[model samples]
Target: MQRFTARAVVVGDRAGTVVPDAVLDVDDGEIRWVGPAADAAPAPDAETVDLPGVLLPGLVNTHSHAPMVLFRGQAEGLPLDRWLGEVIWPREARLTGDDVEVAMTAASAEMLRNGVTTSVEMYFSPERIAAAVTATGARAVIATPLIPLPGMPPLEEQLQHSVELAAGTPTGGTVEYGLGPHAAYTLPLSILTSAAAAAREHNLLLHLHVAETATEGDELLARHGLSVPTLLAAHDVLGGRVLAAHCVHMDDADLELWQEYDVAVAHCPASNAKLASGVMRLREMLDRGIRVGLGTDGPASNDGLDLLADARLAAQLARLREADPTALTAAEAFWLATGAAADAIGRPDLGRLTRGRQADLVHVDTRDLRFEPVGDKEDLLTHLVWSGITPLVRDTWVAGRQVVRDGVCTTVDAEALRADVAERAARLAHGG
Candidate 1:
């Protein structure tokens, strides 16, 4: 057992509760108790550690292709379609399992150092991705990629393999499995339904891209005369743990479909803006009770893996879209990266400082120059979302085990991983 007392503990609940002088107790990789120190029970047998800063639930990245870090800052000044069709796909075609493992190891270490403990990963090489996350002591939900590209197996074979992977993974563990159909435009309706059915059978998450750009679904719409969301509904693929990424071009009817089917959205503001994709109707979605979480997309697209930066960008874009500064408050923005994000991903065990939740915690050093004049609880939470505090993440813990300390990953060698990723990325860039 371990007891950690911090200057402030951000509960990360929907209400954005913050406790001053709080105590968080952990046992067997789960939170045993968390509340004000005055209301805690005595646990003399537990090792005690005092944190001289704010403690928050580790941020949840609802969508990511982390291994794409190998292509970060490449193919710049290109739109989404040209970017993928011209550069990304060709480079990805040459990816080996070892390349994926090494890249994911480095990416996992980068995210952990930035206080992202768990991420929803959709990339090739599921076993290698799992091995990388496990090696770094980080948590991940590996959504098996089911894209219909050249040199890849048929959709039926891919679906069967996804089912096998999900069936083999233990539920509610550090590593989970899901189904990631690349997108509606890239796949057929029959295959989409089949993938959703397989996900339902195994009780796994169904993640996919939907309506990212204005014309991504034009061909499908021309053929079926229905929007992507409605076509998905017609084929019975709307419900059952579906998580749609980049819902930047959705309309009222599409939003209605999401509400009706209880589908969640993974909003990637940074990537959307970078690719010239229009802003999502965040206020409208939230008003209609749609579960929305922030995502960094791929490291190559967003050019970084900082979920806090995405959270801040999400708030900024929402406010600009609504033409109201108060459209999304700082507290709400932070929640989108933490507790609400966990809910969007359907992981109730993460993203909270309550009893029975996984002890994935982040320590933000308040002594940093950026965090000044700690006025009140609201101010603290506001600073967390609004300020440039990514570099202030001093330590991080996943399931009660410290993985990052003093802004460094304790589980992985940062220097060696950087050198290895650079070499592999150079070879990949040259089409090898």
Candidate 2:
């Protein structure tokens, strides 16, 4: 058992609770107790560690392709279509399993240093991705992507592989498994239905991209006279544990469908702006009682794995879209990356620092100049959302294990990983 005393603990509940002078006790990778320091029970057999800063729940990335770190900054200034068709897919065709493992290891370390303890990953080579997550001592929900790329196995085979992976990986572990259908337009309606059915049978998450660009669903609408959401609903693909990413082009009926079906959205504000994909209806989604969480999308699209930066951008865009200063509050933004993100991905055991939850927490150095003038607990949350504190994350723990200390990852050699990725990325970029 371990006991951590902090100046303040951000409980990361829906109410934005903050306890000053708090103590948190961990046992067997789970939070045994958390409360004000004065109210904590005495623990004679626990190791004590005092943190001189604020303790908060580790940020959760609701959606991402971490191994895409290999393509970061490689296809800039291109729209989503050209970006994937011209550069990303072509280069991804050359990826080896070892390359995926190395890239994911480095990316996982980067995420951990940024105070992100868990992410929902959708990419190829699930085994390699899981290996990287284990190596870094981070948590991940791996959704094996089912895409119809050239020279790949049949769609049926891809679905079977995802099922097997999910069946083998037990529920409630550091690594969860899911099925990721690329998109509605990318696959046949039959395959989407089958995949959703399989995911439900295995009690796994069904993640996919949807309505990212204004024209992304044009072909489907022209062919079936229905929007992506409507088509999905008609085919019974919207009812499962579905997580739709980049819902920037949804309308009233589409939003209603999401609420009715209880589908969650992975709102990637940074990547949407970077690719000119437009902004999601964040205010509308929240007002309509839809579950929405912030995501970094992928290293290539977001260009980084900093979830706090995305929270800031999400607030800014919501305000700009609604033309109101209070369109989205700082507390709401922060929740999207923490508690709300966990709910969006159906992982209730993560993203909170309460009793019975996993002990995934981050230490934020309040000595930084940007955190000054915190007059109250709400003010502290405001600073966290708007003041760019990603670099101020001094330490991080995942599942009661300290993975990052003093802003450096403790589980892997970051320098060597960076060098290895550079060489591999160069080869991939040049097609050597």
Candidate 3:
């Protein structure tokens, strides 16, 4: 049992601001109490940490490939398809379980240091990914990598392998499993049907890359005489349960389909912009009451898997698209990254600091010169959003355990991970 009292906290809300003299209490990894500091009833012998600056729920990266940090900035100037074929796919084929564990540990270490506690991971070797996340005590949704290319194993075999991998994982504390069916372009109709059936059988949410590029949408349209969303709907894949990443090229009909299916969107603005993928209709989606969360697609495309930077980019892109300053307010941007993201991953128990929720949080040291006065609600949020306080986060915690302390990771050695990353990345760069 422990109690933490902070001078102020940006409580997750639609109101879009902070609260002064906030107090938060945790027990067995869940928030037992929370309120104004003056009104807090804390135990005398309970361990307490005085966070005088600011405490907020840890940010969630709704989409990522954890071990792909080994490929960051490798194919710098290529588009999504060319980049994947020329550099990403070839390197991924060479990875072993040991390599995945090492690289994912490195990537997870980076996210912890950057105040991301819950991540949505889609990659190869999900067993290793789950192991690293469980050992580290962070939260994640590890989707089994589902490929539909030629010369591949049967769909049943793939599902069985995924079930086997999931069975070995005891991530019940903070990890969940989902189906990762690469995309509509790569997966055949039969394979997709099988994947959807597996997802329904397990009652798991489906995470997929959809309408990521113009070319992808075009190919699906020509082959099926319909959009990807239509195909998915026909196959019963898009329900209130799907987390669709990078829906950048959806038409109005597709948007209607998303609303009908109750699908959530993981908007990766930085990656979309960098890859020359068109900007998503986020404002329109939100207007239609579609759930949307923020994601830093991957380190290779975004060049940084940081959700604060992602939030900043989301707001900036909205403003750029609408040519209006009031496009996405700071509070809304924060929600998209944290609370909304948690909802997208089907973890409503997270994303807030209210009583009875998980104690996944980050403490930001606001005594720095950037935030002159942060006690008030709007000013604190303005400073946090507009003044660039994301880089000033000092610590992060997930499941009531400290993962990053004093801006450093407590689980993995950063220096060692960096050395391993450098060595592996060098080999890939030289095509050895």
lDDT of 1 by residue, 89-180 (tens): 99999999999999999999999999999999999999999999999999998899999888999989988988898898887678999999
Clashes of 2: 0
Clashes of each: 0, 0, 0
Q: How close to the true structure is residue 136 of candidate 3, measured as C-alpha lDDT?
A: 69
- What's the lDDT for all of these models? 0.93, 0.93, 0.83
Question: After TM-score superposition, what is the CA distance of residue 425 in candidate 3 from its true location, in Å?
Answer: 1.3
lDDT of 3 by residue, 1-432 (tens): 888888688876657657688888899988988878888885898898988678888888899987888888888889889998988888776777877888888888888877889899998778788788876667888888788544557766876787666555565567788888888888777777777777777767778999999888777688779889898899777764689999988889999999887898999999999999988888888889888999998888888878888888899999888888988988988889888888878888888777788899899888898888645567877777777776788888897899888888888778988998889887766776
Worst 10 residues of 2 by lDDT: 9-18
| TM-scores, each model vs. reference | 0.99, 0.99, 0.96
lDDT of 2 by residue, 369-393 (tens): 8988888867778898899988999
The runs of at least 3 residues in candidate 1 whose Cα sits more than 4 Å from the true structure, single-residue gaps closed, are none
